[model samples]
Target: MNYLDRKYQATMSVHQLSILLQYSNQDVFQLGNFVPLTALSLPTIIRAAKALVETGFLISNEKDLTELSVLTLNTSFNSKRINVKVALPQSSKPQEKEAEATCNTLMQDRKYYMECTIVRIMKARKVMKHNLLVEEVLKQTQSRFFPDVQFIKKNIEALIDKLYIQRTDQNDEYEYIS
Candidate 1:
């Protein structure tokens, strides 16, 4: 008897049966030709047992009925294994779209603020006294939309360190180095 023939009397859909077997929560049943039906629910055990019996792989005795059964493999076995397919469920939350919109808005706001500050600094550079003081720069840069003097000072220092602007004498009361 072939593996399929010995395991099943009828031509069962190996793929479907394999899937059902794989997901079954019970642990008493083992894979391969012989599998126990005791771990399965009554309906499933009955159906599976009936299927096996119909396929000629199993025989039930009149006495000592058992929920589990064992199958004998035949030498004519040809199939290696069966494959079961399952699909993944989709996500229900729309967080990705919301996050994207928030990120875009923040980026646009940052770009507008940076552009305004750059323009203000450039305009101030032209008329700034030859001796430019940090205080003077801070005052000139201050605006209703951007009043954080400390933040402005830190940004200017970073720009100087990066060579975008030059800083001369740190001790000088007033100086220019761009």
Candidate 2:
């Protein structure tokens, strides 16, 4: 295993190196393999390759002007022991996408108020059909502003996820939990 100076790590960020480590399968890898699998540029890839060579982590077989040559990892290097934090692109992460899809996607105050109206209505009417429930929730909250059926639907799904309400044996019917 190579013990690279942390200062050498500055040549390319740990995240970039981690990316290289991720797609590299065998000891000797062709240059094109990484370009399709990762966002690393030619310069960064060359730099990382050089740094790994300097650290004794990899052995470069060839270096060409137009394209990179094969490179090999040291036998002692283990990916699990790399211990570098790889940062994912912000928008690509599942949590961020989910939040964008639901939480931040809705108008908070309006969503909260609409959810309350739904609970209040469902409390009064224990069981309601899906279409009717949507209709009723919309009808009740109509005074505030017309809520999109889809937005109302998203809130209902969120409520169901929270266990505040559940769908009954009948397809469209929903019953309040409390």
Candidate 3:
């Protein structure tokens, strides 16, 4: 699953994250592991490493110069229902229930992106009917994931309640309030 959740606000760039994922399951890792990756700069790797620590994804340990800077995955980070994907060897597979749990978490993460897209569309349009809003939201988000129709309706209802939008007297159209 992608770790693009806006809630986490990852300070590390995608390449840095790729470097971090290289030692996903290892108990200890060295900073040198990132050197072979020609695309990323050393400073970027170091910043990403520090950001990961700040984000609670990794725990670092002081090490001798003979060894690469030691780091370990923070096990506590996984317990908060934040599913971070660690690369596993081909022979090992996650259990069925664990995979399902990951999927559920991924869906929730996508919902945030969808919500932002809807706001952008609605704020631009100012006023739109239910069907038109749904259509536009789907069309604009076609490159992303297909949203559930019920989910869109629920979001519309929520927007109305929050006064972000208002249902018109016609009962089918909504006008942006803010």
Candidate 4:
């Protein structure tokens, strides 16, 4: 007796719809009027009535109905199958992956910029103190981004690893390799 039952969706039983329609009889009637006619609970009948209201089978005095809410059959409405197309939302996983890749690329570019600044400063000075070199690198890279001293120090170590510079006997200074 299920009228419009679909998998994973709500439905109104045909018997419940018919009882409500038969009782309306071209005049407004309260939902409670059908409670005594059917073995179903009053709340169950109300739910069916609400489903019918959504399908244009019934017109109600209130959009949100209660047991005392008045309803009338929508006699003018033609009973026809409606084709509803629901559009599913796009997945966010791809977007999250793309954002993560972009962030990693930006970090790599920042690291490159810091290393370049270190090499450029060392090449120009030939020899410089560690703290002074760090300050100069910060000054040169500030127009693009403000790099921390720890990050500058890491880049300096990378330059030393690449043979672009070397730590002096002073231990607090660096000497350009070329």
Q: Point to the candidate with the largest lDDT.
A: 4
Q: lDDT tens digits, residues 87-155, model 2? A: 322324666777777865567888899889988988899888889888888788889889899998999
The CA lDDT at 102 in model 3 is: 96
The collision pairs in model 4 are: none
Ranking by lDDT: 4, 2, 3, 1
Off by over 4 Å in 3: 1-94
Candidate 4 residue-wise lDDT at 28:
67
What TM-score, computed on C-alpha atoms, does each candidate reach? 0.27, 0.41, 0.45, 0.50
Instruction: Assess the local accuracy of residue 98 in candidate 2 as a C-alpha lDDT between 0 and 100.
Output: 78
lDDT of each: 0.43, 0.68, 0.66, 0.74
Where model 2 places Cα greater than 4 Å from the true spot, the runs are 1-106
Candidate 3 residue-wise lDDT, 69-89, digit = tens: 776766545434444433321
Q: RMSD (Cα, Å) of candidate 2? A: 13.4
Ranking by TM-score: 4, 3, 2, 1
Q: lDDT of model 4 at residue 26?
A: 48
Inter-residue clash pairs, candidate 2: 130-172
Among all windows of 10 consecutive residues in model 1, the one with the lowest summed lDDT is 83-92
